[model samples]
Target: MGSSVAGLIGWRRATRICKTFLFSLILTTASGAVAQADCRADQVELRWPGGQARFSVELADDEAERARGLMHRETMPRSAGMLFAYETPRRAQFWMKNTLIPLDMIFADQQGVVTRVHSNAIPQDTTVIDGGDGVQFVLEINGGLAKRLGITAGAELRHPKIASSLWACDVE
Candidate 1:
């Protein structure tokens, strides 16, 4: 009788542990979803041949942001992108991992002129996509949008931050 009672207690404890673990898994997933939503909330504006558009730019001014650029996103808005800004133009490369949607990468020189374009980057691809000749800015947009909108090399960006003679704090 005592052995049977101990077995029941052990089973109850095991069930409780399982429930706890499941709950933790759910919470972790929810937290991750919330974080992703928050990270892409802020919007950045840009001009394309179609018209002006806004994007949730994942600005990469440092190593950490650059490393984590747009990974694991299930969807990207048609007008949205991650903009990698550097102090000066340099040779930069990109890859897609856990990025559900394909993209068109637009590389811009320090003067904000489009320098290169990589269209239709396959999702989850680890291929080292090159942006040759260096650039000060890199914009990642929905795949094929660059071609569709006629946003090609030499297209200029109108962001005030890239414009010269703008007040430092007032520039956007």
Candidate 2:
């Protein structure tokens, strides 16, 4: 029948070009995993020792968003914060049970410096709050705004998950 209708129209045009290249490789791998999970909102900068502050963070790096920190937020916006990222410098601990507000944890190092702050905390207060050793980023903010923006203990955060950060992030 005319070479079986030209081999059934070349097998329906090779199955429509293999379903349009598998739908454009699944939409470019789901938009690169939604741009790496929305690159966590960033922007940190602390400085201190005379003063300098600016927050707007929110990164929680993983392990289920740092075990769901800032639990049931009732309100947290005095410039806003919540960092947590840890991949090495250990000895960081925190608690505030179900969280509900009051914070100020800080603690850095891994090059982000700061080392420890702790402050306010009490709000559901489960107590723990250590952050000693070499730490590795923690920031929480709001409670007393890290001693009303002095952010002590050698301060100097400037984020982007401190890859030796002394204030790195220009686009990494």
Candidate 3:
């Protein structure tokens, strides 16, 4: 009888240890995922009714970079984009010119709210694609991606530079 009681206690102790180990593992995994998903300076995140999306981005915050745009790039990664930042809200006009890949332009206002999405602008086309007035930021991605991802006029953009973002960046 004594031996049986010891065995039962040992089993209970092992079971408790197993449960504790599993719980710790779950917490660690959950926290790791959250940490990995933290916002990055070179990344932009957009959210809409359809949920959210992330893109690795190259910033065009200066005059020279914004003027050059995405010109001469034959290929861009699927989850990558160019983010154009303006010092203040103003009308933004874009033309394809020397750009090789078709693009989708997402224009946002001062609050990081998307104001327009121009889908599938023809590659190398010289026609101006006006992003309208009060545009503070623009995200250029591969053509047709905006429509496919449900990125629209009302979506919210989150980036480190968007100081008044409705969707704030965690890393900032």
Candidate 4:
């Protein structure tokens, strides 16, 4: 009777462990699903020491889309922007060439941390604005917005396209 009772207790302990593992797995899966569902494709968020900002973004993810970026848009909303996601981190150089509106370029690394900011780029200036090396993302917003929002180096950028980043959709 004692041995059978011990066997029953062992079985109960094993069952409990199994149940816990299953619960944890389900929770993790649900969290991941929520992250994927909640990360809106049109939005990008940035967090700096002083505060945070959100932009409604148009993605320039392909060669054609990146090349044609904001070239002819006369007016853009104050909270609207364009996000350029590169296939890999590399030296990024941009020019005002055909871009119609003045812009502030925020350059970020593969970890989605801001590396450089070029402010108030003149419209159609055609000057190369270098973002240095290891730039994986570039955000273009209305001129002086970066300064106004206090976004600068070390700011964390969050977008689903960032994949692995300092701040990710899954985290918040």
lDDT of 2 by residue, 1-172 (tens): 9999999999999998787556334323422332233223475666554555556777888889999978998997667788888898889888888988888888888888887788888988777988888887888877875774456888777665676535565574
Question: Local distance difference test, per candidate?
Answer: 0.68, 0.73, 0.84, 0.84
Model 3, position 108, has a per-residue lDDT of 97
What are the per-residue Cα lDDT tens digits for candidate 1 across 1-172? 9999999999999998787556334323323332233212244444444344345555677788888888888887665688887777789888888778899998887767778899999999989988987688788888987775566776655343454231111322
Clashing pairs in 1: 90-134
Candidate 4 overall Cα lDDT vs. reference? 0.84
Candidate 4 lDDT by residue in tens digits, 2-41: 9999999999999987875563343233233423445678
Cα distance off (Å), candidate 2, residue 146: 26
* Candidate 3 lDDT tens digits, 7-94: 9999999998787566334323322352347677798877776456778899999999999999999999877899999999999999
- Candidate 4 Cα outliers beyond 4 Å, as residue runs: 1-37
Between candidates 1 and 3, which one is better according to lDDT? 3
Candidate 3 regions off by >4 Å?
1-36
Q: Which ten residues in a row have the lowest lDDT in candidate 1?
A: 163-172
Per-residue lDDT value at 156 in model 2:
73
User: What order do candidates take by lDDT, descending?
Assistant: 3, 4, 2, 1
| TM-score, structure 4 vs. true | 0.76
Q: Give the CA lDDT, 0 to 100, for residue 83 in model 4.
A: 98
